[model samples]
Target: MSQRRQLPMPRPRELLTNSSHFFAFGFGSGFAPKAPGTVGTLVAIPVYWLIADWSLPLYALWLVVTFALGVYWCERSSKALGLHDHPGIVWDEMVGYWLTMLLAPPGWQWMLAGFVLFRLFDIAKPWPVSLADRKIHGGLGIMIDDILAAVYAWLAMQLLAYFFVG
Candidate 1:
C-alpha cells in the first residue's frame, strides 16, 4: 500500500493572524479536534437566530454575500494551510446550515430538524453533491458540494414542514 501524504495543520498563530483563516474555520469552531464540520454547523445556529427574523429579501441577500465571501475565505485558508478542502475549513458547513433553514418554520423543533437534515445530507453526499466532491477542485469545489447538500436538506426541510409543522 502506498503511504498518503499528510498536510500540515494550521497553527493557532496563523489562524489568529489571518481573517480568512478565522472565518473559514468558522470562527474557530473548525479547530475542534473531532467532527469539526458538525462543530461548525453548531456554531452557525446562533448566527441563524440573529438573522432569522429578517425579511426574505434581506436573508437571501445575506446568503448570497456570505456564500461569495466564503468562497474567497476558504480559498485563502486552503492555500495558507497548503490543503484543498481541509476538514478544518468549515465555512461551507455554516453556510449550508443557514441555507437549510431558509424559510423554515419558527420553532426549536424545526431548527433541530434542519440541523439533522443538513448534517445527514452533508455527511452522506448523495448524487450531485458526491459528484461535485469528486470532480471539483479549489475553493469552489470545496464549497459546491456543501451547497448541493444544503439544497437537498432544504428540500427535505420543506417537505417535513409541509407534512408535520403545518
Candidate 2:
C-alpha cells in the first residue's frame, strides 16, 4: 500500500523572502499569536474605510482585482507553507471580511455586526461553506469557503439593516 505524503509546515523565514508571505499573512496580521484570521479581518476594516466612499462600480472593480490577486498569492503561499488551508494564510479572511461589508450600511454598528457575523459563519462553516472547505483544494479551496461565509454574513447584515437601520 502506498502512504500519503505529508506537506511541510511553513517557516517564519519564508515570510522574509516570499512575496506571497506578505499577502498570505495579511501584511503581518497573520503573525499574531492567536486568532490570526480574526486579526486579519480586523486589519481589513481600515481598507474597507478607504473605499467606502468610492462609487459602487469602482468598489466592485477593486474587489475583483484584489480577489484575483489573492487567488494567485494565496496559492503560492499555500505551496510555500506546504500546508493546505494553513491557519496563518489569512488573505482569504481579509478578502472575505471586505465582501461581508460590501453592501452593509455605513456605521460602526454595522461594521461591528458584519465582523461578528462574518466570523461566526466563517468559523461555523455551515452548508455549502463546509462542503467547499472539505472538498476543494488549492487556492480556490482556501478562498471559496470564506467567500461562502461572506455571503452568509452579507445576507444576515442586509436583514439586520432592514429591520434595525433601514
Candidate 3:
C-alpha cells in the first residue's frame, strides 16, 4: 500500500503575520483540529447574514470580488505553507457556501438547508468536482472544486425551494 503524505498545518502566529493566510484560513476558523472546512463554512454564515439584505446585483458582485480575492489569498497561503490546497486553506468553503445561498429564501430554515446542502456537495465531490480536484493545481484548483460543488448545491437548493416552498 502507498503511504499517504500528511500536509503541514500552520501555527496561529503564521495567521497573525500573514494576511493571505488569515483570509485563506477563514478568519482563523480553519485552525480547528477537526473538520476545518466545516468550521470555515460556519464562518460564512454570519457574513451571509451581514449581506443578506443586499440587492441581487450587489450580492452577486460581492461574490465575484470575493471569489477573485480568494484565488489570490489561497495561492499565496499555499505557497507560504509549502503545500498545495492545504486542509486549513478554507476560503474556498466560505465562498462556496455563499454561492450556494444565492437567491435563497429568507429564513433560518432556508439558511440551514443551504448550509447542509453546500457541505454535502463539498464533501461528496461528485463528478466534475472530483475531476477538478484531481486534475487542477494552484489556488484556482483549490477554489474550483468547491465552486462546482456549490453549483450542485445551489441547483439542489433551487429545486427544493420550488417543490416545497411553492
> TM-score of each candidate?
0.94, 0.90, 0.94
Better of 1 and 2 by TM-score: 1
lDDT of 2 by residue, 29-139 (tens): 887767889999999998898887788898889878878888888899888767787787899998898889887899888888989999999999999999999999988
Clashes of each: 0, 0, 0
Q: Write the per-residue lDDT of candidate 1 for residues 13-122, one digit (tens) a residue.
A: 87898899989999898888788899999999999989999999999999999899999999988998888999989999999999999999998888888899999999
Model 3 agreement with the true structure over 75-95: per-residue lDDT tens digits: 999998898998889999999
By summed lDDT, the worst window of 10 consecutive residues in model 2 runs over: 1-10
Q: What is the C-alpha lDDT of each candidate?
A: 0.91, 0.85, 0.93
How far is 116's C-alpha from truth in model 1 (Å)? Answer: 0.5
